[model samples]
Target: MQDYLELFFNLIKQPIIQAVLCVIGSILAAKIADWIIGRVLSNLANRTSSTIDDNIIQILHRPIYYSILFIGLGISVKAFSLPEVLSFVLLGLFKTIAVIIWSFALFQSFMHFITWYGRQGKKDNVF
Candidate 1:
């Protein structure tokens, strides 16, 4: 039974340090994204009113949440080491994340366009 259990987990040979490194990378990436979002919102708010600040905050929030989730998943992957079982799942996860990021980018662009159009409409009304 012990041999069988060992055989079950044999694939996950990566060291704790490697997994830790990956987690650290994910965390750093999240923090960097946070700072970027903050700075961008600050700059935009300076340029205009506070209306767009809320949208920027909302857009930035989910990526930070998902980055930490991804780190948890990476740590678990290191422990499970069942690549054969998890390969497809991991692939799907990556694709899902990519889609989410793309969606956020597209949504942000749309919001920016709307704001610009609204501002232009106000100008036209004033003239």
Candidate 2:
């Protein structure tokens, strides 16, 4: 058991393994940002009254935000083979994108939900 454990640790110490882990870590970070944005969007949508805006916001923000962030992260992580400073710079940009995505997703959700419910109110009170 000790021998096997040592062998596993040694393999993880390789440069290639580190590179792979960095890429996987970046992807996992992207997924986490995705989840956080979705949750924030849900909360904002529930709070606001404009269902149309909320829906439209969601429609506009959902895929584009995630796609851009994820693609950017993937491209940035691919730069791991570059200089050390470049890798760190790429990570910084990736984090910025994650923040942007999170903020926009929340904004879009609140806007679209407000639009949706606001229209619903108009219909309901028209009687």
Candidate 3:
């Protein structure tokens, strides 16, 4: 038993193994998050009268998934310990991706809000 444990620990210590595990874990985590959001929170949101909750839920999927993926990729990059220039470029790319994901989500949420507001105004005869 102790020998098996030691072997397992040794295997986990390798950088490549660590990187792979981190990536796999991140993917699983993101999937779990998506499931929870889609199955659990979605039901809760559906119970509400407002479309805003539903729209917000829909907007959240990409940012959440990409954020998790980027975090894993960043960790894996460090584990590999490549050239400084390469590492810097890779990290920058990841950051850019993250920023784009969140920015699009924000833009989409804002659009949904505007649409809802317009409908409200129309219903109230205020527009």
Instruction: Single out the weakest 10-residue window by summed lDDT for candidate 3.
Output: 74-83
For model 2 the local lDDT of residue 107 reads 79
Task: Give a tens-digit lDDT track for model 1, residues 1-127.
Answer: 9998786566335555456556667777777776766777556666766455566665656666576657656565655455765856884686589578858866886787688778878978953
Model 2: residues with Cα > 4 Å off, grouped in runs? 1-5, 25-84
lDDT against true structure, model 3: 0.91
TM-score ranking from best candidate downward: 3, 1, 2
The residue-level lDDT of candidate 2 at 73 comes to 57
- Estimated TM-score per prediction? 0.53, 0.46, 0.92
How far out, in Å, is residue 78 in model 2? Answer: 14
The TM-score measured for candidate 1 stands at: 0.53
Candidate 2, residues 33-112, lDDT tens digits: the string is 66666667656786876455446545555555555556655554554466778877877776777677777776777776
Global lDDT of each model?
A: 0.66, 0.65, 0.91
User: Which sequence of candidate numbers ranks them by lDDT, best first?
Assistant: 3, 1, 2
lDDT of 2 at 28: 75
For model 1, the superposed segments whose C-alpha errors exceed 4 Å read 1-14, 40-81, 125-127
Error of 3 at 20 (Å): 0.6
Residues 1-127 of candidate 3 have per-residue lDDT tens digits of 9999999999999998988998898888888888988889889999999899899998988799889889888988889777899999999999999999899999999999999999999999997
> Deviation in angstroms for 16 in model 3?
0.8
